[model samples]
Target: MEPAAKLDPITETALRSLHDIVVPAPVSWWPQTWGWAVVAALLVFAALLVTLRRIKRYRANAYRREALTLLEGVADKLRHPATRPDAIRELAEVLKRTALAAWPRDEVASLSGDGWVRFLDAHDEDRTGDTLERLLDDFEYHGAEIVAGLPSNVCSDLVIAARRWIEQHVSA
Candidate 1:
């Protein structure tokens, strides 16, 4: 059997006509929540911190970048077989100038021959500086004498050593 209606048929009909089915209220987008604000702030701060660090590092390593460019020029100079001795001389000068610029001039300027090589080896991580020092000894002293030509392999080795020295040495 059906249960009896709590309201009269007339009252039920009247209420149904007045309103449809109920629903949840719609959400508004006017105001941002605290969590979202904090997240946005943190993201901005992290981005700024990264940018500042990159700038500082770029500034600090400027000398290394310049030295690498000069080393590239030395490679170009070495391309002509006839110019190997002059290129070798130029290579030593570039490395010396780069080191001198990075450190105190007095400490680096007067150093030559094995003394210069030892200084370079002291800064080098690979310990191949003695080989490079030998090249400087051979080429720098005999830059004008083209009769005793330096081997192509030796010149190339000097280039590699100079590149490593410029890249790996810490400014002191």
Candidate 2:
């Protein structure tokens, strides 16, 4: 038993030598983790920008379709004599509203007082510039008095005129 106790010191030295060769682990892994995070964030941002442009295009297309529909409906209604003054005014208002929705409402509405005259005329086939006001006036103030009542043929002509004007006015 005395001989066995004496052997312990050599065994301890061998065990310590084996442990020294192994390297310790790092305390932090943030640098490597953050590199991956940054790349992911950039990809997300790129995707978002593309999505936003597509959404804008889709909205614009929808607005164009809606405006065209409104104009078409108004033209169809105008294809008859005895068209109501109220209906004409309403249709004009719809066109105005649709224009405002597509463009700037305040600016377009203000154009009504002055520049609007030229704006309309610019799109007119004749370039008379006062056609819009003339048409509107006919429906609003003159329809009941001067025109008395819109005849189907007369209304059809007006419908054709309006359709032509709108077709030329709106951009694709």
Candidate 3:
């Protein structure tokens, strides 16, 4: 190995005076301007409004949820010939109650026969009132005989119409 040569006094003095480079601090995550902060606040407020609207809508439809649960039981009963008559009556009652829940008592309570059918048809998006009319009009009075005479698909069609009415009826 060769011996190292020493620097001149002037060069050594200049080298000793030098220091390491200084780096600036990292950038902040917070908004740099008031406009950015305002935009962020508005976005948060819009999200909160959307969340609250969804919660209010869910709470308002509580009756529909309950009616749907009741309809499931009615559907189970309708599967058997013995229980079909009573289930039809209960199904009609559920539809009436659901209408009452979404509309004023005076408007829905007095409705029956054609008036009831019209009311159901008016609110139903699919206009399935005809399918429900036979069940509502006859099942209440004729009892088991009427249900016995009905085609097998009648009960299932009634159930589908009722479900559609409950789900799509407009609120007054």
Candidate 2 has its poorest 10 consecutive residues by lDDT at 139-148
Q: Local error of candidate 3 at 14, Å?
A: 3.9
Per-residue lDDT over 9-120 for candidate 1, one digit per residue giving the tens place of the 0 to 100 score:
8999998889667998888764468898788889999999999999998898888888889888888777667676677778888888888878898999999888988888
* lDDT tens digits by residue: candidate 3, 1-172: 9999989999999999999999999999999999999999999999999999999999999999999999999998888888888888899899999999999999899999889988888888877688888776776668587685667688888889899889998888
RMSD of 3: 2.1
lDDT assessment of candidate 2? 0.62
The top-ranked prediction according to TM-score is: 3
Model 1: residues with Cα > 4 Å off, grouped in runs: 1-47, 143-148
TM-score of each: 0.72, 0.50, 0.89
Residue 148 CA displacement from its true place in model 1, Å: 6.5
For candidate 2, lDDT tens digit of each residue in 1-172? 4655555878889877784466779677554677788988999999999999999877766754676677677766565444456557656676566557656666577766446556566646555434456566555556454443656666555555655565556532
lDDT of each: 0.80, 0.62, 0.88
In the predicted model 1, the residue pairs found to clash are none
What order do you get sorting by TM-score, best first? 3, 1, 2
